[model samples]
Target chain A: MRSVLPVLTIVAFILGFWTLAVVPMNIHLAADQAARGDMVVEPDDARARQEVGAFALALGNPAVIPMTYTLDRPRLPGPQQVVVELWNTVFAVAPTSNRSLIYHGWVTLSATLLGFGMGTALGIALAVGIVFSRTMDLSVMPWAIASQTIPILALAPMIIVVMGALGIQGLLPKAIISAYLSFFPVVVGMVKGLRSPDAMQLDLLRTYSAGPAQGFWKLRLPASVPYLFASLKIGISASLVGAIVGELPTGARAGFGARMLVGDQYGQPLVTWAALFAAAITAAALVGLFAALERVTLKRMGMAA
Target chain B: MVSVDGNPQGLEHSAKTARSAVISASSVDLTFQTNDGPVHALKDVSLDIEKGDFVSFIGPSGCGKTTFLRCIAGLETPTGGALSVNGMTPDEARRARAYGYVFQAAGLYPWRTIGGNVKLPLEIMGYSKAEQEARVRRVLELVDLAGFARKYPWQLSGGMQQRASIARALAFDADILLMDEPFGALDEIVRDHLNEQLLQLWARTEKTIGFVTHSIPEAVYLSTKIVVMSPRPGRIADVIESTLPRERPLDIRDSPEFIAIAHRVRDGLRAGHADD
Candidate 1:
């Protein structure tokens, strides 16, 4: 309860700030809406309203301040607007409906999970190779580091186009981009983990005349678990971002990215804000799941204090 | 034991002793080439460790005691001269799994229980499931850690963790044991208790043991043969065969013979530093 209070306070603070900011951001639109009604509005012409600053318009027509929060197609949706949209899109409709955020969420989540799995596996394999072989350590590590520097946004469209040409349409292209983004952290982290054993530890194994495979399975692999989990948390979030970005540029007509694009094109700010918040919530949940798994696994392994 | 004096006669004498020795090192030198220049870690270091001998290599840091121990365990290679373990080259003997080595630190894998850590070498050696269990049980009992097998290393104290490490080393039933300052990190009270337990373990096992340490009383109390070493082109300063009986108690360290041996080790260490 003590821990939860701080989080609640911060969340409340953000909501309060958002509620205050909505008045100025949506005031111009509210003024026009109010002017159409029997309510009073200063500089009632729509073009004059556009020319005037939002804060100035709100000051000119104080009666329009209350209507700002209720405006349709608000420039900056209020927190309550986003919350209602989220409730309607996520819970009010069937999951299979195009209007439901759950349907879109599942689309993005499937690609994220698939890509994360592929990326983690490839990263671990590469880390093992780099650790055991001098050639791979020298050759592959530089390339892996270099791969992350290329903007995923720039590369995602190219991957979609290339894969689309090969008749690979829906999830695989997005998953591949997710895999590409997610693998670097795992590679770097797992490499550090695999090499964490000190000189004495390695010497003890050498004294036993333990082979490389035995050394890896017995010592290196166990030592790397904490490191691997740390990377995995970072990797999963990166994978989610990759899945969303992969939806962008390709005009992939589903997932959080598509919802965001649709909301943006149709001028439904509440829809875009709701999708954005849902994506944030999903990323937090994914990371939280890994953190819980890490706690349990490390505790079972006696690594956690 | 034959003393190495850098003479033809001394060389011949060591050659004769090497025949019956379990570990034989003749003029073994190791020069580590750093950016500064060649730093001689060992120089003409000769020693003959017979079967069932509890030998301790005592000296200051950088005196090549641990290096020499590592050479015997095949964890290090001498730049010059021949060293053999069990009638085979050190590397070949290592492959044959001739020795069990205990390092300075406990170095238990935090992810493994005490039993799992002890079972590591046995698993690597491909001992059968039944034999592995039996050996782990036996060795844990030998180290007085029988009941604590399920406990993790972090759950144990430093002394207990080190004891578990010893149990791990002993699980494979090797005929030779190499230790590098195995109790260096412990408190004196715990160190003394472990030293007593180690002597008992050594007596029961009767394995040819090579231990490295800088502590005067520890070297005197634990070793049947103490090789006092000197630094700066590390070489043997003295090799004192203990006159104390095999059945030693903790109080035996206070005896005249034990003090005499410790005095000799102290003197040898001082003499090594005289030239510095």
Candidate 2:
């Protein structure tokens, strides 16, 4: 209840401020329309309006604030309007329809999941290589860091063009992009986690005459679990961002990013905002799911999850 | 190929008389080449530990006592001279599972319960499931930690965790047990209790135990033989064999013989400093 109260209050405050912001952001259009409809009534305090505040003046015409909420293409849609739009796009359309946020979300989600899986596997493999081999540690790790310095924006389009030229379309390109973004954190995190065992513990393993395989399976691998999960949370989110960016370049017509592109081109900002919110919620859900898994796995290992 | 017949020391000769000497280190030396310079950790270190002997290496910090124990466990290599365990090279003996080692810290895998930590070695040695369980239970009982086997290392007290580490060492039934200041981290009261329990444990198990510590009383009361070491180019200053009987009570620490042995150890430490 205590946690819920703070969240509710914050949401309410944001909505209140959003509603107020929409009036000013859209009031010029409303005023222009009011004038065009021959409904302009100059307030008695019109001369004093400049000093009294624009909000006080806007409050004089109840129709103006309400009209702002109903605009065809509002600059900043009111909270109620966004809520209504969210409800309509989610429930009013068939899930398979192009207009349905569910369909778009599913498309983006598929790419994100695929990319995340590839990224995590690659990251762990690289981490293991780096940990076991000093040459890989000295050579590959710096290169891995250097790879991220090339902005994904510049890289994504090039990848998309290159892959598109080869006639590889849909999920693979996006998954590759996601894999690129997600692998770094996993490598960095897994390296640290695998090395977390101190000198004494390593010596203990030595005394047992444990082979490299046995040491890795019994010590390094289990030791890396908490770190792996931490990286997975970061990697999964980065993968989602990668998926969205991957959608941006291809002029694709299916994913959340594609819907956003349509809304952007058509000036239907509600569609763009809805798609943005859907992506955010999906990322949050993925992180939450992994956190639960981390808790359970670490707890079973007798560690503080 | 390896012979230690030249040593004129009575302690060295007594080990030969037993015909069951488990560890023999003759003129063994280790020099660590660090960034600063060469640091001689052990030099001309000669000793023989008979089977079931409780040998303690007592020295100040950085005195190479732990280094020597590590060499016996095959965790460290001597740069010069010879060391053997159970008539085999340390490395070969290690692979043959000749000994179990307990570090200063409990060194329990935090992810494992005490029982699981104990079972780790058994698992690595390819013990059957039933055998693993039986051995883990037996060792835990020996360490007075039978009830706490299911608990995590963090859940136990420092002393209990150290005991669990000892239990881990004992779990595989190795002939030799190497402990590097296993109870040094605990409070005095706990250390005393663990020392007594360790002596009892040694008496029961009859494992050839090599312990490293700085505490004179601990060295005197727990060991059949004490090797006092000195710092900075570390070397053995003196080796004292206790004349005390095999059966020792907790009150043994208060005995005149125990005090006399402790004084000799202190004098050896002081003399090492004097020689520097």
Candidate 3:
């Protein structure tokens, strides 16, 4: 935390201005209007106070200040309103109610973790194969790069439909989508790491009468640690992208993606922004967990910085 | 006939050199394939290292000093001729771990602590945990680095690192020690001190040592026999037996006996150069 404090500060500052100041100001301006007997900017002429939702906004008359405040398009929800709704939806809603962010978050997190695990396993297998074989390097490597070029947003829906046709539904299709998007970095990073042994080190290993297994386990694996961690960082972020992409095609009514769809239909911009922020936070947390695991493993190997 | 006595005098010139030789490479050849034709690095070389003897190979750069050492270490198989170490192939010797080799550099694994690096061979040979720790401790003390066992390689000085490497080589309890210019990278002062220490260590253990160096003084100071080699089809020009005593002091390098052997090594190397 001490070393990363500067980066955290810069990120926090940027998000602070963008979320609180820039987003809200634009929303207010866009929402402001004198139409339908409403004041463009609410007039506080030492006068009538109407509690326009959680806040006292001064206006000439009760009916005069019409629907102008509610006219916000691409709106940023007021902080207090979001807070109340979040509390109501998250804590207040039970199995009896449908507005459960916890359930939705769990759904999304499950898919992300499943896909991340599958992707990491497949990525490691492919990387080892490619590293050990010239044929795999010639064939699989290019395909991995090409796999990402096919625009995941476009591919996600097709994958969901195809898996549905194949009688595979529920979590598997989403996990597959997530895995597909998340594995390229693992392969690339691992390949580079596996090849990182210096000539002198290799020669020393040769002198030891060590077989390929011994050589790889002793030298290449140790050398590849930093690269593998680097790949994992990239992989976890891509996993979030996969889960979101999966949601679009599946019309997942229970997760954050489903909420985005509903918000877009109802023209509730704050709900969508809130969902986006939640996903970003989840992804950041996942990567942070990986960072912690990396430190522990590398420290044990005596290769930690 | 070779004499049975191990006297300092009449050892080289008398009836014969010791025939109870452990390593005897005769008409040995090594050719490496280049973009052009094959380049012969070693050819028609013949030499013998007696049991429990210290021999050094010395010459100028590209003299195949290192190549010869590598051949003996079984890291590189010779292209031609018969070469036997302890009456077995170098490959066989290596698999048996008959020799402990120290490279020109320390080559200690940076990721490991000094003790851990020393235990690498013990681990490879699969010693018991208790045995590994005991041997590592003993070797660390042998090299006078018991205090720094827990420290990383980078934390040690060059001289200390070199000593750690020596400890690593000695850890496995191999019969022969093959060192490739192990002290070549050290300063003159450090090299001199290590040479004396190595002589003492060798005398104490009675281990057969094969060392390669380009320094004539270093060769004369440490070796019981010096194999003078030349490049461009590297072969031995002379095998001068050193008359210097086994109990070498650092200042013994300044003695008349050491000076005379140094001159003999210089002459052998110059003769090889003239052939080129």
Candidate 4:
């Protein structure tokens, strides 16, 4: 409850800024719409309005300000318009409908989850190999780091085209892109976590005559949990971004990315804004879920303060 | 073969004078090759620790006191000379689980309870769950940390955490216990109390103990034999045998005999510094 006030204050500030920006951004459309109703508009010409700076045109036609929030196809949709569209798409329509945000969210989310699982498993396996073997440490780690530097945007389309040529289509290609994006963070974090034990701790294990397998299970694996969750949160968000970008190039018919592209092509900014907000919310929920799990696990293990 | 007959003062093992050497190092040398140059961490370091003897190695930093202890525990390889534990090579003795080592820090796993941390060695040694629990219980009680078995290390005081570490070392019931300044991080008051408890523990366990420290009183009060070492090509400068009886009290430091031994250790340390 104490935290609610500060969060609400921040949300209100962003909404207020958005409300103010709407008039300038949609001034040309609002002016055209107002002129149809015989209302006063700057220059009384739609073509002339586009040449004018949005802020200058908005200042010139103050009377059209009230109509900016109500434009049918706003250049930048107002916050309230996005909220209404979100409500209609998310709850007003059946989940199976192509127009429903839930349907699109589910499509992206399933891909994200599949990719996240594969990436996490692969990352941990690679990290263990690197930690235990000098060859993997020397050979794979540099490549893993170098792989991340190749822009995911440039790589996503290439991956889709190659995978498509191989007769793989739809979710698998998108999931592979997500796995590529997420695996690096997990690999780096797990390596650090698995190697976190100090020299003294390792020496203590050596004194016990513990085998490498015992050392890993009794010391390294348990030690890496906190670090694993930290990377997992970052990986999930990156995975979502990867899935959305993956959709952009493949011309996918359904998913948040498809909804965004469709909205842009069809001049429906409200649909794009709604999909954008839904994706942000999804990312937040996934990260929150991991954080809660981390707390519970660390608490049980007596690692948490 | 270097004989153990040179150190006349270190022969004060009374009734246990006939006991065989559990750990014997003759001309044990270790030189660490580094980017800067070769570091003579230990040089011709020789000592014999008889069974059930409480031996303390006291020296300043870089004196190879801890390094010698590490060599004994088979955590470090000697580049030269011969060292053995229980008539076997240090590596062989380690594989046989002949000793338990306690480090400077507690090094308790945050993810484990005190009991779980204590049970770590037992678990690795393939002890049954029931036996692990039993040993954990016994060691925790031995360290006066019986009530803290379920608590995490962070919840305890520094003193209590150190005790928990001691309990962990004792859990495996090994014949030899090697400690490298285990109480170096604790407060002086806690140090004194722990020192008393340690002597009692040594009496109860009858384990061959090798301790490293920088304090004179701690060395003289706790050790049956004190090996005073020097830095820079680290080697033993003096080996002093304590004349004190087996039964010792905390106030024994105030006794004339304890002070005399402490003074000799202090002189040995200064002489080591002067040589460099």
Q: Report lDDT (Cα) of residue A267, candidate 1.
A: 89
Residues A108-152 of candidate 1 have per-residue lDDT tens digits of: 999999999999999999999999999999999999989988998
lDDT of 3: 0.78
Distance from true position, residue A135, model 3, in Å? 4.3
**CA-based DockQ, model 4:** 0.75
- Binned by DockQ into CAPRI classes (incorrect, acceptable, medium, high), candidate 4 is medium
Tens-place lDDT per residue, model 1, B106-214, is 9998888899999989888999999988998999999999899899888999999999999988888689999999999999999999999999999899888899999
Task: Provide the TM-score of chain B versus the true chain B for each model in turn.
Answer: 0.94, 0.93, 0.93, 0.94
Q: Candidate 2: misplaced stretches above 4 Å?
A: A1-13, A41-63, B1-18
User: Which window of 10 residues has the lowest lDDT sum in candidate 1 chain B?
Assistant: B2-11
Residue A23 in model 2: lDDT: 85
TM-score of each: 0.96, 0.92, 0.83, 0.95
**Model 1 segments more than 4 A misplaced:** A1-3, B1-19
Clashing pairs in 1: none
Which candidate wins on DockQ?
Answer: 1
User: How high a TM-score does candidate 2 get?
Assistant: 0.92
Between candidates 2 and 3, the one scoring higher on lDDT is 2
In model 3, which runs have C-alpha deviations exceeding 4 angstroms? A1-9, A12-32, A40-72, A75-101, A134-139, B1-18, B268-276
**Across the candidates, what are chain A's individual TM-scores?**
0.97, 0.91, 0.80, 0.96
Residue pairs of candidate 2 with colliding backbone atoms: none
